[model samples]
Target: MQTEKVIEHIVGWLKDYATNAGVNGFVIGISGGIDSAVTSTLCAKTGLDLLCIEMPIHQAASHVTRAQEHISFLKSNFSNVTDIRVDLTPVFEEFKTEVSLDGNQATVDMALANTRARLRMTTLYYYAGLKGLLVAGTGNKVEDFGVGFYTKYGDGGVDLSPIADLMKSEVYELGQFLNVPNSIMKAAPSDGLFGDSRSDEDQIGASYPELEWAMKVIEEGKTISDFEGRKREVLKIYNRYNNSNKHKMDPIPICEIPSDLK
Candidate 1:
């Protein structure tokens, strides 16, 4: 579908989902990335009461600035858009001091990074509960499912995901169609969990466009033997990330028995 139609459909779906689910509004954590920018714009288009929150825990200044800018844009275009900033640094620091871990520094750093996401998740849901709103998620297809890059119960925990099916490339396209600020649309995507502000590509080892192509190849049941050169490299990277993160994407395993007794 065209970007215009996709935007309209997503808007309509948001409206219908809220109406059916009896939610009064949506609460979304704005990370200053294209996905969040597009998701917030779509939620605003639904005409429901919405809260665009910037929960910064030692977040990058550039990211916070872009988030506030996008929030301002949303407020100007949509009166129902309510914006707020929550600082979770103190909470994170306290938690960090309280917890103890054994392993390499990398492991500890990763755990702390994920803690930031979970802290924001808690903040979003806290407000959502108070306002009777659903927590809207911003993850796109590539990050959410293709490589399972989101932290489970952190960025992955949401009542509704409006764009989990869109590829990262598609998200950029929709952001442009929505007239999102060029700064955010062109900004490197990141989870904002790392204090040093590494781009998602830096963390993932492959860019979104490359990841998207590799996702297609894998989903089609193609083997690495089917390609050579750059294609093989892409497949290798995809498999490395996707295979290790499978636990993040799959549903919880449950023990079940047949009802043959009946």
Candidate 2:
């Protein structure tokens, strides 16, 4: 899909947006995933101040290693890139102590995982505010629009999304073109919120390619009755997520006051 032209377009767009906004540059959380690696690289290409932050809360070793590897690669290649590692494990533990944990194990665990993402988001914004930088989001098309797989007010919180229009496969293509660290490019896609090795596929129950196909067919006006077997199963999975996470995808509900009432 004119990969080179697409990359140029995104880079130009980012630079223009930041200049128009009067921000120094961007700050992004490096998660060692394909999306972040590609998005951060795009930011670096703009030749603006790029701060790569590593905020880990009970994160897996592999994820941490890949994140560090990618950051190192960026620093070596880009003169404008800088990085910092913020260990939030203690902060997370303290937060857990203050919150209610009365729910069932699964429910409580899910909440805590989302908390991890929110903490990282807060950290990024904190720096953004202090340094006059915009918080750059790393979400892609499938995760951001198709499945709504990210945490609202958490990873979904951002000043701008550079890759939200690109599909997961397209993000990978950008990663390849950007020369992201091999370790990150090869690792399984994950949210890293659960502090485990569970891949996004494990949580979503569908590979990105499968979800991409489903998203395309659905956009083309296809229905569940048109497919069978595994295709049907994948469609069901995609539909369930798309429906349930619509809140994340849509604008926040605002109650409009009647003119008489006002």
Candidate 3:
């Protein structure tokens, strides 16, 4: 498939969907990661209202710097752009105490991480509400389809995704085409919930380039009978998330009454 044609098709899909849904814009969390930067740039090319939320919490100085760079890049390109920087330390701690979870430091940290992610999602949706915007997810094909590298109910909860079909490596290729800054593209992809030590690939135990090929074939409408070792491992990871977060992956169930009208 031609990459340029695919890019144009994806952008066109976003615009046509926005018009059909009666939404005027697309809101994306600009985390300074390649995925978000690429997504924001592509959305901008569509000439839609794009809001980039810079929500940082207990993150390192480098993350904030890169985020600003992304904002500057977006402003230079996109016509309608709003950059909102909301520090989430206070809100995170308050939510932790409110929940009353008495766990160790690791559990506490995970809670804080999930809190920050959900908080950002909430903030984006608020502006989305005001502007009749749809949240454009930043997850790539590898992150979304291969392994579940996103936070449950956080980044995964979005109206639509433009980059969900592209792998991480392919995303960088497209970013190069869009003239995304080399620094931003080469920087480590982080959740920024962790200061610097952890990363999506490191946590998942497989790089995007290593996993994308297998991901594409398995997700296609084809079957294999002899998937014993590596394929088994992939299924294990996929199954873990699929079982763990079934609620997040599915719609709410309607409760049935004892006597209901049919």
Candidate 4:
């Protein structure tokens, strides 16, 4: 598919979703990453009131400068861009101390990362309500349909996702197709959490290409006959998300009641 057509499709998807949701514009988290960068650009080009917010923790200094560059790109392209710098160190510290989770560094880092994600989500919803815009999800197909790499109430919460159906590789191609800044396209892809230690592939143990192939096979209804070995591996990751993120994927929870007189 031509990249320009993909961009147009993204715009149309957002337009349709917004119409259904009764919203006019989009609010995106600018994490100095490729996914958010492209989503912001698409929202801007469609003449939407695109608001980009930056919420970075103390651990993720790798993309701090990149965040500013992304804001610059958004400003030049979109007139309704808002750059908000939210430092979440104190909040994360308080959370750790309150929960007595200040012992484990990994847990602390995870908490901090989640704190940033939730804070950014809050900002998005705040302005989304004010401007009558929906919160645009930057997660692509690799993260969305395949593995569910996003956080539950944090990055996973969104009003709509325009590029959620596109694979990560497709997003890269679309970036070049739309002439997004090389800073964004060439920049490394990370969650900007835990001192740049957490990567999409690192946590999933599979690349986007591999995940896409498995997804296509499942989509075609041609199951384990071909790639049974690979299917097993993908199933492991798939099940991990299913087991760990119950609240994120499921319908409203129902409290289990004991069967007393059955």
Best by lDDT: 2
Pairs in clash, predicted candidate 1: none
Per-model TM-score versus the true fold:
0.96, 0.99, 0.85, 0.82
Candidate 1 yields a Cα-based lDDT of 0.91
Candidate 4 whole-model C-alpha lDDT, 0 to 1: 0.75
Estimate, for each residue in 50-138, the C-alpha lDDT of model 3 and write its tens digit: 88888877778877888799889889877788777777777776776788677798787777777788888898898899889999999
Model 1 Cα displacement at 37 (Å)?
A: 0.4
TM-score of 4: 0.82
For model 3, where is the 10-residue window of minimal lDDT?
217-226
Summed backbone clashes in each candidate are: 0, 0, 0, 0
Candidate 1: residue 199 Cα off by (Å): 1.0
Question: What is the lDDT, from 0 to 100, of the residue 257 in candidate 1?
Answer: 75
| lDDT values for all models | 0.91, 0.95, 0.79, 0.75
Write candidate 4's Cα lDDT for 88-194 as tens digits.
Answer: 66766676676655578877667766776786677778877988878888999767756667776788889878788788889998778767778778765787656
Q: Kindly report which residue stretches of model 4 are placed more than 4 angstroms away from their true locations once superposed.
A: 16-24, 102-112, 221-247, 253-262
Pairs that collide, model 3 = none
> Across residues 43-146, which tens digit of lDDT does each residue of candidate 1 receive?
99999999999899998899988998999999999999998889899999999788897789999989998889999999999999999999999989988888
